[model samples]
Target: FEYAHETPKRNKRKNYLTITTGAPTKRSYLCVQSILYFLLLLNSVIAIIMWATNWYQLIIYKVQVLSNNSLNVELWKNPTWQPLLSIYIFNYTNVDRILEYSEKPNVKEIGPYVFREKANKVNVTFYQNGTVSYQVRRNYTFLPEKTRGSLNDIIYTPNVVLLSAAQMIKEKPWFVRKTLGALISATKVSAFNNFTVNDFIMGPEDWFSKIGLNLKRALGEDVPSKFGLLTKRMGLSGNFTMNTGKYNTDLVGQFEYIDGRPGLGKWEDEECDK
Candidate 1:
């Protein structure tokens, strides 16, 4: 009886040891599982952060590219009237191409007048006293029908003389008169490549509209609807005349707001305002 009782006690002690050991093993497994879950969560958070940053950068780059492209297209289309005038002035005085001049007459000054003609080109002479005379020609020949309009009618008159105007005077006041004389003297310089009727007709707004149309066609349904809406709101439609008047207003206003702004001709700003 004693031996049987001792054996039962030993068996009970063994069972207790087994239960304790198994409990520790189970706890270790649980701990490992919890660590793995934590690592997974951290990785997911890092991935989300990287993805968001990339998306933001992409969006910013896209906006910048779109804006720059739009501006470039506008410049290409409009080519600014001042630059064209500069080119014309350069051509008139520089080249020996002006017909009817016995010699390359020294053009002492230019402007305080707006002069334009339908001929391949036209020449305007500005004397010392501010009186202006212009001749129109087709292929270097005076075309009576084409040149019928008065200087006021034909030329898109300038608001200020290229030299005597306040803006030019202020920006280069000391050299204003001298620069005008030099420009006339140097009229025989190279012709301006970008000046064209297309540039003359198309304004900044027209350029944007044309670019938007082309973009729309290229992108088709891939373009975002919101972008299209924005373009429309910015007046990127085909009606250039409406925007032309506003842009002209802004241009004139720029000169007016500046301290040394030139005194533009009444008809010059008036025509553009209309």
Candidate 2:
């Protein structure tokens, strides 16, 4: 009988074992894929929740200049017109906290306090290149939800307003000038609320903390360029005194102070100051 070499049963058995072990490996791979899918789903759910709750908080303060006398936009933009001021106002400040972090500044993001336009807030009038009068009708500071106010609440109109001074000066009609020259600015502001700049802070991370939070230490109430300092530099000190009121705690309160004119007649004439 021709002895044909029979294939070894042991080798054949070993190959079968190897093929069978692959089933567990396949199961493990499927488990890993399932875990990855679950993680992705969890991430998606968290993103949706964040979008609905905390992403839409924003406050906008609209600036409007209205006068009894018609203002020529073209004329106001004249080269001779002085650049009065770029009113940099904010609702609050946390410079003391920001200063703590220089390199590895551990920072935390706070809130979305919103300002709503409302009536009976603050109104200032101007005329003859001077502030004729102003009124703090109602306290403007409020929590975001409290911003339900009329159109007149947020619009600012002034008569005899002095925008800035480089050296010069507008010619309005007599009636227009007179109307704008009135000492009292008319608005829907309320008299019941007379809060100052300091009354509205609920907490360090509240609404006021979120609006116009200035980090610049050199500006605002701490600086020499404030109303009092600038006047003092011009040798016009002792001319007037200002009585400070409380600030709005709801939104951040910016320039809000009452100055008592001690007979401004002592101010140097235009030619003399020049």
Candidate 3:
């Protein structure tokens, strides 16, 4: 029994290997941070490309001038000079950038643009029926040549009204129909941006449409729509401009007036505004 107990000897030791999680966790965290940096870079690039390029703003003024044969508007008659304004939208560059963009020249413009007026609509009878003659004329051009202001090429065409025939005014007398009163006016026009959301990729119109896309698309040329009555109204008129949807303006002068001209008084009296 003693010999048998001694023969059955064996070593029993517990050997163990441990795997730590810290290294794997650190690797995974680094990978996530790398992805985040890449995503941020891409987002910044997209934002830069979508920056605004061509910019335009328009201001419209409506003036209803009350005039009879005695005091017709005389401002338009002096051809020696003309009242006008001009804005040049470049081919993505301007006078300063001309050096940078010398090779690519695209000067777009809102030309020697100004409130040009139609000829006076006069039914003057100097001798009270000496010659019962009435004359009316209306024409519109985006920019006229040699006007007062920097002149540019006539790039845009306005809605022009050409009177083709005698307007059958009234049955009783020509004088009765013509004496109602005359209105002087200006305008703002509307049209769908050339692109939809589908084409918003780079269309300036699409960017502008952002002002009121749904309303503008539905209205589709709100100002032009009302143009039907412009040519046949109380007096002559001219046209074009802007994306701001506008409505008919109330008469300011006859009822109340705003001396639109600065440093000027009543245009009727040419006296300083008091």
Candidate 4:
């Protein structure tokens, strides 16, 4: 018998095409990680560059003081503001009553004489050791609008010259004091004098001041030729040396020396001299 082999029909291959979103594969994840790392590195590099650039600019503008530093130097050398100066005077109305009648002196407040002070840094000299020396010249201009009283207003007050002269000789020998007292008595100078505000503040070019100046000169005292409340300080002050902030910003404008002296020697006390 010829039996035919049974032929099993092959099942039709089912081709079901389904598409769905899912997490990235390992290769794609690694690529994304590399891109993120590249971006982070770029940001870090940019930040470092910006920090360095800002530091350099700050050093150049703020810290370093050189001839080429135009902005700082210009502002320092020539200031635009005019500062105000106020003066108050006390007038003794009852000097004679206090001296002769033994009564309390009547005191009166005179004024608030305002003035516009102009300052200039003259003779600015720079040294190689990062130091600068300069002299400040000051001038006062009366501002009548801001003043409570006139400069020509006359008022009576104690004689400052006479008192100062007496104080100077008080500690000296008794003979010296007596001789000076005789000289002062002969001049007919009283304990009080009438002076204008201008004369008192600027300086009184009167007979008393002239006589006092002459006597002090004769006595070999180191006193100013002209005596006034603010006369001697009206002109240029002494020379001052300061750091330039070239190497150290903290030391900028710090006084290295004043009038070539490291410390002031005008006071009697050692601590006060500095």
What is the lDDT of every predicted structure here? Answer: 0.34, 0.31, 0.32, 0.83
Clashes of 2: 26
Which candidate order results from sorting by TM-score in descending order?
4, 3, 2, 1
Steric clash pairs (candidate 3) = 91-106, 252-256
Candidate 1: misplaced stretches above 4 Å? 1-28, 51-53, 63-274
Q: Tens-digit lDDT track for model 3 on 1-274?
A: 3554456768887669776765557788999999999999999877665552222111122122222231222442222343333333222223333444454344554323343444553442222212122344444333445443343232222111111011322343555344311210122222111221112211223222333333233435233212222223324332211111123223222111222223234355544352
- TM-score for all models, in order of appearance: 0.17, 0.18, 0.20, 0.76
Q: Give the distance in Å from residue 197's predicted Cα in candidate 2 to where it truly belongs.
A: 15
Global fold similarity of model 4 (TM-score): 0.76
Task: List per-candidate RMSD values in Å.
Answer: 26.7, 25.3, 26.9, 10.9
Better of 2 and 4 by TM-score: 4
Q: Candidate 1's residue-wise lDDT over 1-274, tens digit each?
A: 3555344454444444442333457788999999999999999999998989988765644432222243332442333432112112211342243334445534423222222322321233223332222222321112334332222222221211222222433544465457545654565322212222222222223333343344444534233222221222222211111111122323311222111223333346754533
Angstrom error at residue 191, model 2? 38
> What's the count of clashing pairs in each model shown?
13, 26, 2, 0
Candidate that beats the other on lDDT, 3 or 4, i.e. the better one: 4
Candidate topping lDDT: 4
Regions more than 4 Å wrong, model 2: 1-103, 117-132, 141-274
